[model samples]
Target: MTEPRASAFITRNVLFALVGGGLGGILFMFFLIEFDHFTSTNQFCTTCHSMTFAETSYQQSVHYNSPSGVRASCGDCHVSEGIIMATYDHAVGIKDLFKQLFGADYNDPVINLLHLPDAAFASRDWFRRRDSATCRRCHLQEAIQGTRVHTAAIHQEETDGKSCVDCHFNLVHRPVPERSTFKREAWNAMVEQEFGLEPGSAEQLLAAGRRPAGERPPAAAAPAHGVGNGQQQAGLEP
Candidate 1:
């Protein structure tokens, strides 16, 4: 009787321990996934400070001012409508994860793409196309109404071409409005001058910072005299 009781007790303890350990592991995994998924840092919409321009504009727009109290993150506007699309976005994020880890290709505003890998050049096109989709998704109602000038451009796209954000991103969520311009001709010419892009069908709508390559613009140039170290870049125009 004594021997049988001891065996039973040992078995019960082992089972309980195994169950507890499994549950703990599962909970930890869940916590990690949530932490990675919902963070402001993880979202591509907030990936670049330049991207946040529209975020600021929306906060001040009629959407936020209305009594209904509607507020949205970048995901709400930029993500596609289906699970398939969401999964695709996550798949693409793996590259970004590596970039963040290595501190490669950071954007301007210290948050935007300050450096770009000229090697995988198609990535920029992918980013722009996706952003354009997000614009159409949220502004579809407004586009239907045709209240804004850009909406006219949206209507012209054959299929997926109508993303209002592609051309008209003016919002900055922060009190400071950073002025960034996408100079189509000058930027391409500059990038070609530096990178020596081969002659081919090039996308003209690509975005570029107003700053000159390898040198900061006068407005963004370092201040002659300041309170702190000269390392600090000038804040964007409000």
Candidate 2:
């Protein structure tokens, strides 16, 4: 009789433990889901001092100030879709956290400006590597009917294995050339003329990963947008 009672007690406790564990797991998952959602908001993204420049430009762009009232937050463009990719993107973003805490004096606008080129290039490259997947999340190629017929034609047909970033970059952030046409000489000149930065100062700072001075290279002309390859290089300006 005692043996039977002990067996019953063991079984009961095992069942109760399983139920408790399962409930705890669900609550933990719920917490993670809520945290992810909160982090995706524009408010959360621009909280860092480094992101203030981005926020200022984004707020003025068509993404935030559209006539149709359509608004795309920073995450909608930068963060990939689906839980797996989204989580991975957030993981990669931990670099930004580290930089904010221990990296450059990004609190200064001039110093921050020097680093913007690196950030812009890195982001554009990420989009290209991902085949501009985040852009595709909202912009379906087949569904695209641009104001110009040439634009829609470019979307559906005759092109290289080009992604959206190939042509339609500079949509939101400070205008940088599409990667294919990005010349370091042009960039150096633009920054010099635009911000009074000496040519190659950015490259030096980027190379050092901080605000260190170095020799300035000769400047050249800025990049101009070209309309070629059925790629409507100048689409509806945002």
Candidate 3:
């Protein structure tokens, strides 16, 4: 009788353990799915106390409001495609999170503007590292059969070694120079032009040497003798 009772007790405990584990796993998955969905939203991204600058400028960008009525939200560009990669991106973004919470007072337009290039360059580099995977999500290079005379050839040429942001940056933010030509004065000039800043205020900031690398210096340019010249001849870019 005692042996039989012990066996039944052990079996009951095992069943309860299995049920509890199953429920816990389901709840975890549900939380993960909901959290990933919510965090991918533009509203959630811009909810930070310091994201007003990004929110406003993004609203002004073509991705936000386009002629085709196909608007790309913040997540469409910023978030990776798969759940795993997207979570990795969010995890990496903790640096930005800490900055917003404890670093510079980005609420100030001037401060935010000062740091804008840093954010922009980081984003561009992310695209490069991912081989412009996010851009390719919407724009298939082979499918870009367009009216521009040089578009097809340029696309083919760029495919040899270039990523999309290598030549196609500055479309969505205050303009930064092409990576090949990015220098301090040039970046300052563009900032002034787009932001309607005082004619030389940015230059003055440059002169004062505040944040020497507002935009990271371009990589040493590749040889301009072949591919570079071809793009130039076609009136396109590298």
lDDT of each: 0.43, 0.67, 0.66
Error of 3 at 150 (Å): 3.2
**How are the candidates ranked when ordered by lDDT, highest leading?**
2, 3, 1
State the TM-score for model 3.
0.70
Model 3 worst lDDT window (10 residues): 217-226
Best by TM-score: 2
RMSD in order of candidates:
11.8, 7.0, 9.5
Judged by lDDT, which candidate is best?
2
lDDT of 3 by residue, 26-133 (tens): 998787777778898988987884565566656777887888988887778888998778888888888988877777656544445555667777889999999999
TM-score of 2: 0.75
Candidate 1, residues 1-238: lDDT per residue as tens digits? 3456666766977988989999998998776555445642325455554344344445566555656665555565444545556556666666866654554323332122222223123433454677556555556543464567766655655337534444443232322212343333333343333233433212321233233355322222212112112112223231
Query: What would the TM-scores of all predictions be?
Result: 0.38, 0.75, 0.70
lDDT of 2 by residue, 5-83 (tens): 7667669779889899999989987876676677789999978866776777777778789898889888888888876
Q: For model 3, what is the C-alpha lDDT against the true structure?
A: 0.66
Best-to-worst order by TM-score is: 2, 3, 1
